[model samples]
Target: MSEVDEYLRFFPYDEPYDNQGEAMDRIHTSLERGQDVLFEGACGTGKTLSALVPALEYARDAGKAVVITTDVHQQMRQFVQEARAITRQEPIRSVVFKGKASMCHIDVGYEECQVLRDNTRELVDARQEEAQLRERERQLLSDAQDGEERAVEARDAVVDELENVAERVQSISSEKNVCEYYKNNLTGNVDEFYEWLFDDVRTPDDVYDFAEARTMCGYELLKEGMEGVDLVVANYHHLLDPMIREQFFRWLGRDPDDVITVFDEAHNVEAAARDHATRTLTEQTLNQALDELEETDDPRTKRAANVLRPYRDALVEVYEDSFGFGERERVGDNWEDVAVANESGRDDLTIEFLQRYEGPGYKSDLEAAVMLGKDLDDQYEEAYKNGETTTRKDCQTLQSAAFVGAWMREGTDEGLHPVVSVRRDQGTDEVYGRAELYTCIPQEVTRELFEEVHATVLMSATLRPFDVTEDVLGLTNPVTMAYGLQFPPENRRTYAVSTPALFSSARDDPQVQEEVGTALHDAVRFTPGNTLVFTPNYAEAERYAQRLRQQGDATVYLDEAGVDANDLRERFTNDDDGVLLTSLWGTLAEGVSFDGDDATTVVVIGVPYPHLDDRAEAVQQAYGKAFDRPGKSDPGWTYAVEIPTVRKTRQALGRVIRSPEDIGVRVLLDERYTQQSRSDMGKYSVRGTFPPEERDEMIDLAPEKLKFAMMNFYQDNGRYDGPPPAP
Candidate 1:
C-alpha cells in the first residue's frame, strides 16, 4: 500500500476519491523530502481534509509540529474540526490561534494587555515559590520524631493547606477579575495545561467558553498552549509577521527548521503579505494626530506636531492638485509630486541621507522632520509604559510618526515603492490625501520565509498556471500537483455569449455598458430559482443591479460596499427565488458554496481586469523587468493581468457546482473569451521568435442560441421540475 493508503485508514470515509488519494500522496512525498509543495485541488475534492489528515499524520510520526495558516478565520475553524475528527484515534493536539484583537477581552487594549502579561508572570512565579515553601515546611514537620503527635496534627493541617493552595490556583480568576482567562490557564504547569486544553477544546468558541467561565485570558492561554501543539491553526498574518513568528517558535520550544508550514487558499498569500508590509498615512489619520496633540500637555509632542505640520500640508497640496477635488480627471503630474515629497532630484528617490545620518551627508528639511518624528515616537512609547495613559490619539500619532520615519528610511530600497494620491467624495466634496510606501513585488517579503521554513505546502482551488504562480511567489523547483475537477463534466454547463460588441474594459462607455447589461439580462431571464450576477467591479455590479431593479421584474439583492457579504448571501439563499448581484472579487466568488437549487445560474458579466492606471502600469513594468525572458515576448502582462483575471473567474465559476449532485449553468457575457491571436514573428524580430499559444476558453453562442441552449439544459438536467421562472 502507498503512503496515502496507510493514512486513508484513519479518515472517516471508507475510501478516498481518486484525486484526494493522489493529492495526499504527492503532499506526503514532498513534505517528507523537505521540499516546498504547490498544490491545486479543485472544488469538491475535499482539499481541506486531504491536506490536513496527511500533514497531521506526518507531524505526529515525525515528532514535529505543523503550523497551518489560511486566509480567513472561518477556514481555520473548519480545518481544525476536520482535523479533530481525523485525529480522534491519535494523541495529536490542535488549537485555533486567533489574533489578540479578535480573542482578547474588551476591557484592555491589546498592547496594554501585553504589558500586563509581564506583571502576571511575576505574580505566578511568586505564588509558586510560596507554595513550594509551604511544602518544604510540611515535609520537615512530618520527619520530626520529638513531636510525633504534633507532627501528625501539623501534617494534616499542611495537607489541608495544600488542598486550599490548589483550589486557589484553580480559581484565582474569581478573586482577581482582571484577565481571569490568562491566570487560570497560564498559572499552572504549562505542559499539563497544553495537553488538557487540547483534549477538551475542539474549536475557538470552546476555548473562549473555557476561558470565560474561569475569567481568564483566552489569548494568553492559546499562546502558551501553542508551544507544543501538534497542529497550530491561525490566520496568515500570524505566520507572516516576523515578531509573531519569533514568539510562535519560542513558544513551540523549537527552531524554524523543525516545523512544517501549510498555507490554505494560498493564492491570497501575496496580497496578505503585501498588506502586512505596506504602510500608509492619510489626511484624516494625520488630522487625528493633530487633534490629539491639542489635548496633550507634553512639550515634545507639541514640537513634533509643529515639525510635521508643514510636511503634511505640502503633501496635501500636491494631492489636492492631482485629485482635482472631485473633478472628472486628474490635473497634476503624480511622478513630479512624489519627487517633490521625497525632496529628491530624481523621480525615483532614495533615503541615502537617512541611511548615513550619523555619517557625513547633507540633511534636508524632510530628513530632519523624519528624524524628529522617530525621536517623538520612541519618547512617547517610553512614557506610555511609565504609568502614563497612552490615549488612543497618542498611539495614533506615534504610529503615524513611526510609519513616516520607516518610509523615509527605506523608501529607496528596490523592493519598496512610494505612492501619493487623493480621493474626493462627489457628494461631500471632502478630499483625503494619502501617502503610501508599498512593495510592488511580494517576493521581497516572502522569499526569506520560504527559505527559513523546513517545508511549506501551498494549496488552493484556483491556483492555475503553475509557472506564473511559481515565479510570482518566488517558489524554487517546488513539487507541483494540479488535480482536475472531481465533479462530473456534465455537472456544470459553461457558455460564452457571441455578441456583436465585445465585453472588455471599453465597457466603461455608456453604449457598451447598455449592451452588456442587456446581454446579461437575457442570459439570466430564463434561469430558474436563484441566480448570481457577477460584475468586474463594484461600480459595474451596482450599475447592473440598478438596471435590473428598474426593469421591476425580479427581486434583486445587491452586495453593496457597506453590506456584509455573508449576510447578503444568507438573505438571497433564504429567498425562494431572487438575484444576487456581486463583484467578481467578492467573498461570494470563491469560499461561498451553493447546494442543489439555490444559486443555480451564475452570469459573469465581463472578464475581470484591472484598470490600466499609473499603478497598474508600474506593476506590469516591474514584473516585466523581473520575470520576462531575454529572448521571448514579455510575460509581464500575463502575470499581472490575464492570470489573476482567469483565477478570479474560475473561483466565481466554482461557487455554483459545490457537489457532484449539484448542477448549475455558467454564462460568460464577454466575446473576448472566444478570441485568439498569433504572436507576430516580425514584431519579435529584435528577440528570438516563438510559436503562438492558445488563449482563454471559448464557450460562445449568440444571445438567442445561448437562451435556447440554457433552457434545454435546465429542462433536461436541473433538479427542479418546472420551467425557469419568468422575468
Candidate 2:
C-alpha cells in the first residue's frame, strides 16, 4: 500500500464516501505542500472526519499540532466525538478549550475573575512573607539573648514591623473577595487529571465535572493539558482576537508556523473578524461613568469627571446636529408624548472635528483624565482586596478613557470608519447616541494570522464563489475546491416557481400577495409531513403567516423575535403536520437539524437581502472602491449583496435534506431565481449562484403547476399514500 493508504487507517469509518475520500486526498496534498485549503463540501459529506483525519496524519509527521476553531460552541462537541473515534484506532490526546467565562466556577465576568485571582495570589504571598518574618524575628531575639551584637541590631530592625506585616496580611486574606477555586488551583495536584485528560478525548463539560470533583479550576487544568495534546478544539475568538490569540499561542508553547489550523464554518470568518475589530462607546456608559465619578470622594476623580463632562456634552451636541432630539407633541385629549424625529442616523467623525477637543489644552486635560481614571480603578481594587466591597464593578471612567485613547491611536486607518449614530434601544425604546469605529475589511483582521500559520483549512457547506472569499479575507494563492451534494438526486425535488416576485417594491401589492399566498397554500397542503416556510425577515414571515392561516387548512406557527426559539422549535417538531414560518436568517435556518420527518418541505419565499442600512451602504462603497476592475462588471453588488443573499437562501433550503436517507422538496418562490437574463427589473439572476448540480436539476414551473410537481414527486418517492389533493 502507498503512504496515503497507510494514513487512511486513521479514518474511523468502515468506508469513506466518494466525496470524503477526494476531500481528504486533496487536503492531505495541500497540507504536505504547506498550502492553505478552501474547501466547500455539502452536508452529509462527513466534513468533520474528512478534514480531521488528514490533518491529524500531517500534523503527526510534520511535528505540528492541529488547532481547530469554530464559530459555534456546539461544534466543539462534534470535534470531541470525532477525536474519540480516532483514538479508538490510535492513541492521540485532544483537549476542548472554552472561554474563561464558561470554564469559571464562580458567577462573574472574565475580567472580574482575573482580579480575584490576582488578589488570591497576593494574599497567599503576603501570608508566607508574614510567617517568614515572624520566624526570623524569633531567631534574632534568641541570638540577641546570646550576646551577639550584630543580632541585637537585626532584632531591632525586625521587631517593630511584625505587627504591621500581620495587619497587611489580614487585609489581603479576605474570603469574600478572593476566588477559592483559583487559590486551590495554585497548589492542587493535577497529576491524575493530566493523565486522565490524555487518556481519552475530554470535552469542556467533562473537564468541568472532573475539576469540580477535585476542587480545582477547569480552565487552568485545560491550559496545563495543552502542552502535550495532539489536537486543540477552541472557539473563533481564541484565534481571531489579538490578545486572546497571543495568550493561546503562549499556552501551546508553539509559534503559529508550527501549528496547522482549521476554521470550521469558515463562512462566518469575515463577519467574526469585523466584529472583533469593531468598538463602540455608548451614551449610557458615559453617563454611568460620570455617576461613578460623582459618587467618589477623590478630588482627582472629581476633576476627571469635570474634564469628561465637556466631551460628553460636545458629543451630545453632535448627535443633535445630526439627528434632532425628541419633540413633545400633543396626543389624545389632555395627553402628550415625546417623539424622536430621527430614530437612527450616522455621520462621519472627521479629524478636524476631533482636533477641536484634542488640541494642546484639551489634550492635556484628556491625559490627566486618563491617569485619574487609572487611579480611581486602583482605589476600587484596593477596596475589593480589603473586603470593603463584596463585588467588583468595572471602572467605567477608565473604559471611556481607554476607548478615547484607542480612537486616537488607530482610528486613522483607511479600513476603519469612525462615525457617530443615534440608536434607540429595542427593549426600552429609549433613544441614545454612540460612537463606533467600524472595521470595513475583514482582511485587516485575518491576513496576518493566515500568513503566519503553517497551513490553514477553511471549510463550510455554503462557501462558494471562491474569489469573493479570497478577496474579502485577503488569502493568498491557495488550493480551492467545491464539492456537490453526495446524496442521490432522485430523493430530492427542487423547483423554482414563477410566482410574483417578493421584491421590496412588490411586497405591499395586494394582488401579488394573493397570488403568492395561493401558491404557498397549495404547496403546503400537498406535503405529507411538517413544512417550513422561510421569509426574508420577521415582518414578512408574520405577514405570510396571517395570509396562510386565512387561506389554508394547515396549522401555522410564526416565529417571533425575542421569544424562546428552542421552545418554539420543540413545539413545531412535535406537530407532524404543522407549517412553521420563520426568517431565512433566523435561528432555524443554519446549524439546525430537521432530519427524518421533521421538515419534509422547505419553501423559501424570497431572496434574503440584507437591509440597506448605513453600514450596508458603507460596505458597498468600500468594496466598489477596493475591487472594481477595468472592464468587468462592478463587484460591489455581487460581493456585498447577491452572493450573501443566495448563501443564506441555500442555508435555509438545506434544512430539509440533512442525510442521504432523508427525502424533501425545496421550492424557490421568486421569479428572479429563474430569470435567464438580467433585465431592467433585476440586474442579476441568482440561479447561477447555486452549485452546478443543483442548478442543473432545478425545474421551473408556473404557480399553478407547483402543486402537481410536488404531488408527483411525493408519489414517485412512494411517500404519498393517497392521490393528489383537489386544486
Candidate 3:
C-alpha cells in the first residue's frame, strides 16, 4: 500500500472467508493512517484475516512493522501455520517472538559443550567400569571358592578413579544451552559474533533452544538469519511488559505505537494486564537462595551471598512485624513498601548490586547470579566451566526472586501500588502465593511505557462491569466498544435462574444440595455431551460437584473444588460424557474454549464474588460508598475482583457454540440473575436468557425441562447428525 515495493509478495487469495477481504481492507486503511485497529469477531467470524493476513500484506507493502498479539499461544501457532501456508515462498519477513528463556543458548563453545559432555560421559563410563570390575571380582571369588585380594584391590582402585573423575568433572563450571537469548547474549558475545550465533533460529529444533512454552517471539528473534525480519508476532508481555518488550522486540526497534499491533482475542487485556502486573516472591525462596549462595565460590555465587546478607538482616529485623508463625491474617496493605523501607531492603540498592555483580571472568553478573538456584548452586562452577544447561524454569524457577517483581509505575501522592504476596507456606510442595498490584497506580514499572504508547487496542469478548475494570485499571477514558457476538438461535439455548439459591450464605438448606443434584443430573442425564457447571467458590464448586458425582453424575470438578487448569482441560477433552462443575467465571471459565462437540451446555452457579481478602476492606471503603451503595455492595465481594470474574463467565459461556451450526446451552444457577449482579452479567454476555424475559424458548424450566430442551435444541439444529455426539 506504500512506496515500498518488491520486498516481498504473496499470491492473492482466490477464495477467502466471508470477512477476510473486508478485514484486510480495514487494515490497509489503518496502515495508511498509521492507526491501531481492534476487531472483535465472533468465534467463527474469521478473526485471523482481520489482522493476520493484513499484517503480512502490510509487512510486504508498507515495510512497516506488524505485530499479532494473542493471549492464547495455540492460536498464535495456528496463525503461524496459516501464514506459512499462504506465503510458502513469499519473501514476507516474519518471525515469532518469545521470552529469552524459551530458546537454547549455545552460551558455550562446541568444545566446551563437548568437554562437559565428554567429561560427564567419561565419569559415567568410569563408574560403570568400576561397577563391572567389582562384579567380576565377586564372580571370580565365587567361581574359585576363594578370595582374591589382588582382584578386590583392583576393583577398589577403579572405584576410586571413578569418584575422582566425577569430582573433577563437578569442579568446572558449565551452563545449560537452554535458551537462545542466553546463548545470544552470552555466547554470541553481543560484540564479536552478533551476526553468527546471535541471529534468530527459524526452525523448530532451534526454537526449543528457547522455552517450554515455545512462545511466538522467541522463534523469530533467535532465527539463524534474523535480519530483514518483517512481521514480529508476540503476546502482551512482549509488547507491554518493559523488561520483556525491551529484550525480545527491541531488535525490531522500540516505536510500537508506530508499529501496527493486532490484538487477537484482545478482550483479555484487563485480566492479562492485571496478571502481568502482579508480583510474587516468598521467604522459602529467599532462604533457598541463601543456601545456594553458600555452595560455590564462583564470583556470582559470592555476589548473590553478599547481596542477600543485608536483606537477610533486614528481614530478621522486620520478621516479627511482617510475619508471624501461623495463618495470621495476611500482612498489611502497604507491607511491601514497609518491608523494603528499612535501608537494607531498599529495592534500588539490591537491584544495583544484582545488575552489576560480574562473573569470575567479567561476564554478565546476572547470568552468573542465575546459577545460584538452591538445587544447583553447588554445581555452578562445574556447569560453567563444562557447559551444561541448568537453572530452573518450572517449579524450581518459581521460587526465584529475580527482580522480585516490584512496581513503582505510579508514586506516593496518587497512591502507592503496595503489595505483599502471601500464601499458606504449605512448604515447597504446594506453595501458592497470590500477588495484587494496581499497575495504573504504578509503584515500580516505568510510567513512560503506559504514557508513551501511541495507541493500545484492548479487545476481549468480555471485559465486564467495564467501569469496574476502568476503576482498577485507571483507564476509564479510553475509547470503548463492544460487539454483539451472540451464538445462533439454533446453535445455543440459555436458561436464567434455572435453579434457586444454588450457592450463597443462604444456600445451606440441605434440600438445596438435592435440588442442585437433580438439576445437574437433568442437565447431563440423557445428553452424553460435555456439561460444565460453574459455581461461586471453590468450596461451593466442590460441594455441588461432589454431590453430583457421589450420585455418579459423571462430573469433573472445576476450581474451588480442588480442580485446576489441567483438570479443566481434561474434563473439556475427556471421554466420560465430559461434565465440569466449577466456580462461576473462574480462570478456566474465562480463558479456555472448547470447540466442536467437546462442549454442549455450561451451567453457571451463583455470582462470582471475591471473599474478604486482606486488602478488600480498604478497597471497599475507598470506592464502596461511591459506587456500591445501599445494600449493593457485599463485603464478601471484592467488586474490584469479582465483577471481572463474572465477565469471565460471559466468556466461558461463549466457548461451546463457536460456530453457527454448533449447539450448546448456558444455564445460570444464581437467583441473583434477577437482581443487582444481573447488570454485571449482561454487560459482557455474548448469549444468554436475558431476564425480565426470564426463560427463552430453548430454556427448559423443570423436571422434563432439560430432556425436552435438549431434544428440541437438537431436533432441528444439530447438523453434526453425521453421527451420535457428546450429550
Candidate 4:
C-alpha cells in the first residue's frame, strides 16, 4: 500500500466513503503545500469529518496548530464532538473555544467580568492561606479536653464548607467578593479544570453547567488551555475579528505561520465578514447618546452632543424628505447633492459645516465624548458586578459622529454603499430611522482574511460552478475540488413546472397572482407526505397559502412575517402531512434538514431576484469594476442577481434529500427552467446559452414525466453517471 493509503487506514470513522477519501487526500495535500483549497462536497459526503481528519493529521505530523471555525456554534460543537472521537482513536488533543460572552459565568459584560477574573487568582491564594491557618487552629482546639465536643463540631462545619466549595461557592463569592472556586481549584489547576470541563461538554449548555458547578469561568479556563490544544473549534466571528484574532495569538504565544484555518460552510464566511465591516447608526442610538451626554458634567462632551443631536436631525430629515415615512426608498448615489439637500444648503456650505465638526477642535470633542461614554458604560457594569441594580444609558453620540464623519469625508470603497431609511408608527407617526454603510460583494474582505493564514480551506455543498465562486470570492487561483453524490442518485430528481405563466414583478397583477397561487395549490394537493413551497416573497407566499385555504386545504402552514422561525420549522417538521409556504432565502431555504418523509417534495416558484435599488445597483457597479467588465455584458447583474438566484434555488433543492436513504423530488415552477433559450422573460432572451451545456441535470415539466421519473428512480436506485436519465 502507498503512504496515503497507510494514512487512510488510521481514519477513525466507519471507513471513508469513496468521495470522502478523495476529499481527504486533496485537503491533506493542499495543506502540505500551503495552498488554499476551495472544496465543494455534497451533504452526505461527510465533509466535516473528511476535513477534520486530514487537517488534524496534517497538524499532528507537521507540529502545527489547527483552528476549525464555522458560521454557527451548533456546528462548532458538533465538530468538537467529532474531533474528540478521533482523538480517542489517535494521540491528538482538541479544544473548543466559544467567545467570552458565551462562556461568561456571570451575568455581566465581558470587560467587567474579565476584570473580576483577572484578580481572582490572587484573591483565591490569599483566602486559601487564611483558610489553612483557620484549619490548624480548629484542629488544636478540637484536641483540648475542655469543650472538646463543641470544638469538633466547629472544625467539622469548617471542613464541610471547604469541601462544598465548588457547589456553593458562587453564593459565597457574591457575599465575600471573591471567587471561591477559583481560590480552591482553578487558581493552580488549569489542566485539571479542562479535563473536568470537557468530560461531558457535548454542547454549550453542558459547558455552562460544568463551569457553573465548579463556580469557574469557562472562558478563562478554555482560553488558558487553548495554547496546548492541537485543534481549536470556534465560531467564524472569533477569528474574523482582528482584536479577537490578536488575543488568541497572544494566548498561544504564536504567530499566524504556525496555524491552518478551515472555514466550514465557507460560502457564508465572506458574507459574515461583510456584515462585520458594515456599520449602522439608528435614531435610537443617537437619542441614547444625547440622554447620556445631558446627564454628564463634561462641557466638551456636552458640546459634542449638541452638534451630534443636529446631525441626527439632519439624517432624519434626509430620510423623511427623500424616502418619506413608511416607504423604503434607496439613497441617492451623489453624496454631495444628497448632503446639500438634506442639510438645506449649497454643496460648499454643507461641506464646510460638516467638516467643521471633523476638524482638529471637534476631533478632541469627539475623543472626549467617546472616552466619557466608555467610563459611563464601565461604571454601569461595575455596579452590576457589585450586585447593585443599575440601568445602562444607551448613549454613544460621538461614536455615531465618528462613523458618519469618516464616511462623509473619506466616502466608501468602490463596492460598498451607504443607505438611509425611515420607519414610522401607523398611529403616532413616531419616526425610527437608520443609516447603514454596507457591501454586497465581499471578495476584498475575503481576500484580506485569506492572507492572514498560512493555509485555508473553504468548503460548502453548493459552491458549484467553481470558477464563478473563485472569481466572486477573490481567491488567488486556488485549487478547486468538487465531489458528487455519495448517495443513490436515482433517489432524487428535478423537474420544471412548465406553465405559460408570468411570475415576475412586471406582471404582478391580481390575475397573475391568482394563477400562480392556483398552480401552487394544485401542486401541493397532488404531492403527498410533506411538501415545501418556495415563493419569491412573503406576500406571494401568503397569497398562495390563502388560496390553498380557500380550496379546503386545512394543512397549510404559512410563514408569517416576524414570527419565531424556529417554532414555524418545528410545527412544519412535526406534521406528517402538510404543505409549508415560505419565501426564498427565508428560514426554510437553508441550514435546515427534513430528511425522509419529513420532506418528500420541494416546489420552487420564480427566481427570487433582489430589487434593483440603489444599494444593489452600487454592488453591481462595484462588481463590474472588480471583474473589469469592459465588454458589453453586465458582470454586476450576473454576479449579484443570477448567481444568487441559482445558489438559493440550489439550497432549497438541497433540503429535499439529506441522507443516503432519503428520496425526494424537486419542481421548478418558472418557465425559464423549461425554455429552450435562457429567458429572463417569456420572449426567450438567452444570456449566452440555454441552461449551459455542461449542466445536464434539468428535465421537462410534464407531470407524468415527473411522477414516473421520481417513482422509478427511487424504486431502481440506479447509479448516476454524467448524463441525465430519460423521463
Provide TM-scores for the models.
Answer: 0.81, 0.88, 0.62, 0.80
lDDT for 459 (candidate 1): 88
In order of listing, the candidates' clash counts read 9, 0, 62, 1
Question: Which is the winner by TM-score between candidate 2 and candidate 3?
Answer: 2
State the C-alpha lDDT per candidate: 0.68, 0.80, 0.51, 0.66
| Candidate 3 residue lDDT tens string, 419-495 | 43434443433323332333332212322443444434444555444544454444425444334444456556676
Q: Which candidate is the best by TM-score?
A: 2
Q: How accurate is candidate 1 locally (lDDT)?
A: 0.68
> How far off is residue 468 in model 4, in Å?
3.4
After superposition, candidate 3 runs with Cα above 4 Å error: 1-31, 89-91, 105-206, 209-226, 278-417, 421-455, 464-481, 501-503, 526-528, 553-576, 584-587, 615-639, 674-708, 715-727
lDDT, residue 495, candidate 1 = 80
lDDT score of model 2? Answer: 0.80
- Model 2: CA > 4 A from native: 123-171, 174-176, 292-307, 318-361, 382-389, 405-413, 419-430, 675-682
Candidate with maximal lDDT: 2
lDDT of 1 at 453: 80
Please say which candidate is ahead in TM-score: 2 or 4.
2
Per-residue lDDT over 331-385 for candidate 1, one digit per residue giving the tens place of the 0 to 100 score: 3322222322232332222233233233223224335434555555565545444
